[model samples]
Target: MTMPHKTIPESNHAKPVNLRIREDVRVLIDRAAKIRGKTRSDFMIDAAYRAAEDTLLDQTLVKVDAESYQQFLDILDRPPSGAGFERLMNAPKPWQG
Candidate 1:
């Protein structure tokens, strides 16, 4: 059986960014890029983008135990307080002012 091939979507390349690195770091990056059959810029961009994504995701992701997870779900299931509806109904319209 032949395994299906996944395609990478085309990326937008309208913006450019410049970076400065030491010679030693540049040499190591070049070596790794060669081994991966990718250009130095492509390798650096992909690695940097992945690292940025991982950093942001690490910050935003939540981990909870089973009991805490159930409590969280229970909170979401609760009905909203009527105060919100009252505030909306009493608020002045911007267009009227």
Candidate 2:
């Protein structure tokens, strides 16, 4: 007599994706990954992360109009000095006064 057959359980989750790339790009990715001693996925993830960070930093960086920027540069170049500096530094403290 034949033994009873048991069916294997089937998974409903979809398999992870695989990307098909051009041969030259694939070679380039492989070379870069090898140079860094990382897998292609790790290299790509790191590169993407860096690109996002750079984009965000560029966006967040403060930019001023030419006139305003020049004024800022002038102020920085000609910082106050002499008695003004001394008075500001030697000003009486609220607790002392």
Per-residue lDDT for 1-97 in model 2, tens only?
8686332234597355578889999899999999978788767766766788779988896878999999998999996899989899899988884
Stretches of candidate 1 off by over 4 Å are 1-9, 63-66, 69-97
Q: Which candidate comes out best when scored by lDDT? A: 1
List runs of model 2 lying over 4 Å from the truth.
1-18, 61-70, 73-97
Model 1 lDDT vs. the true structure?
Answer: 0.83
Q: What does candidate 1's lDDT look like per residue over 8-76, in tens digits? A: 345685578889999999999999999978889888877877788779988996788999999999989
Span of ten consecutive residues with least summed lDDT in model 2: 2-11
lDDT of 1 at 43: 86
Q: Which window of ten consecutive residues has the lowest lDDT sum in model 1? A: 5-14
